[model samples]
Target chain A: MAIFSLWVINKAGGLVYQRNFADGLAQLTSNEHLVLAGTLHGIHAITSRLSPIGASSGAQVIEGESFKMTIFLTATGTKFVLFTSLHETTTDSVLQRVYEAYADAVMKNPFHTPEMPIRSEGFDSRITALIGTGQS
Target chain B: MTIYSLYIFDRHCTCVYYQDWHRTKRPKPAVEGGILPAVSHAITPQPLPADSNAGSTFTSPRNTLTSTSGVVIAVNEPISPGPGLYQTPPSHQQTQANPPPSTSGLAFDEEAKLVYGVILSLRNMIKRISGRDEQFTNYRTSTYKLHLYETLSGYKFVMLSDPNTDSLRFVLRQIYNGPFLDFVVRNPLVIMDSKERGIDNEYFRANTDRLVKGLSVFP
Candidate 1:
């Protein structure tokens, strides 16, 4: 199984960070990438509003030809988007570990700015290490 | 989950049209002023030598005709050898003569040029390496996807959409065959030879917007 990429979106639908582990994907302009995050956030909000009573409003999986997207939302309104190959089945645990790492390495960092695009080296290294072990 | 914009470039690497729908931080148009010339210069196909044309069929209009995935493509015929669309600007040389300015303000246009350059380079590289003149359809990233449909005449239709958006090659072809060919290409008033300009007709814009909105999955 292959993991393609990852994205982090804030509550305002802005993309805070993005990383690609695989190649051959179409590259987007920085503005276009930001627009994509906003669009997804709007779609998620609309989906939540349309949800039936007693059901969760957040989107979970978006399946494609060769890959699948899994969205994990945090209590503080942060979103983690994981793009994994179709055969990858154990993603929940992976997402949970990533969330834990983000809380420890990003949120707790004194230099990290709130609601801005994440630029912390610690967060990157931690997430990279987590992804390495998860893939193995 | 949404479409941000659409850009159409001609065979000359001129961005003939650009439209934004859902983008927030719109970059200044002047920022893109250097991209067209840079890209045109980068991807100008090498001219064939005089001896290689032996026995080649001399077709009227000089355009090469081919079909891919049910879409008809017409390769653009070389118009002239002089300074028409193929000429690269001297500004590129001026930068060599004098020191270039800092790149902080040119980030957006730089990325745009890079994207176009990469696409053109990859297309030519793949054709040469694989020995197949296959047409590019679409490519996806983790968050978004880009769809491309090119006419034989070298007019390219490109759309940026959500990664999970179903294949829209047929839709792009339809737009090309239906509204684009009818309203823009064939219209006498619409000048196709202009540089750094888009098709500026209300009829084309209205109809195209309608066509795009009519799609079942567009949101």
Candidate 2:
């Protein structure tokens, strides 16, 4: 089980935070990450509206043969997105841990601004530590 | 605990078949046929006497849905008195060729086009992220999940069901292999991707309904 990458999108649909691991997958440029993140944001909103049921949530999982992307949307509209291997059994636990870390390291940080690119060193180390332990 | 609908898109990206069991507000008819949209309004006043046991207000509109859908449901009524497997006369099947009539009022051609667009963009995204060997199976919303099964022949079978249910891709595959192959693909009488017609027939609809009803999660 391995996590390939992580993306944090602000409520405004901007790519605020992005990171990559698992070197085997093809890498993307910063521009590509912004484009992909924006596209995903748009698609997520469209999917939520596509359903005939009440529109509380949108797409949660997009699975491929080798990897799967799990998206968690917070009540405030911020999205925590993760791309992991298909065999990753601890995704939910890992995501819960990451959310807890975000609440601590990012949200509580005085230097961190809302809806902007995340650049705090403490949050970076915390995410790295989370991903390190997340690998099984 | 409900299966909403199923749509089959042929190679040309045209919705060739559609069926829905529990859907509430009907989809507005596409602007393609100004007359058909008018017909939908005219038919809305009368309600179909359907079993309300599902605790859904959706079943009330089943009878006056559309001519093609109305016939398909009526053919399956207990009044027909046919065995589990029996022949339905060719006349009982919807055979309109020109104008490519939409079957059910629950979802129209316009909605099907949006369905195709969703999957198409999702599939394209999957391709961009992973190799060609990988494909997307399903995506979920708060209320429902959409399962997709793509055939080598370019047929796409999409089913929407309760979000709590497990993967329904296997069920979609079975439909493609069973009823779809038997009634549509294998039969020479039906054109595969004709723009002027849909591939829906009584045999396929009955078998699909039976298959969905047989599912453990169906409610």
Query: Residue B96's C-alpha lDDT in candidate 1?
Result: 27
- The stretch of ten residues in a row with the least summed lDDT in candidate 2 chain B is B53-62
Give the residue spans of candidate 2 off by over 4 A: B34-107
TM-score of each: 0.43, 0.74
The TM-score leader among the candidates is: 2
* TM-score between model 2 and native: 0.74
**On residues B1-219, what C-alpha lDDT tens digit does candidate 2 reach at each position?**
889878788788877776777766445433233112111232222223222211121111222223321112342343231122224344333322111222333325446666787788778777776646567788877778888899998889999888877788899989988888898788787776666567766777788889888988787
Model 1 Cα lDDT, one tens digit per residue, A13-127: 7789988776434555667667656655544442332111222234466444445667888887788888786668877788898899889988999998888999988888988
Candidate 1 wrongly placed segments (more than 4 Å): A1-136, B31-112
lDDT of 1 by residue, B97-191 (tens): 22222111222333344345434643543233223455545544444556777788888777766667877878778888888888888998777
Where does candidate 2 clash, by residue pair?
A: none
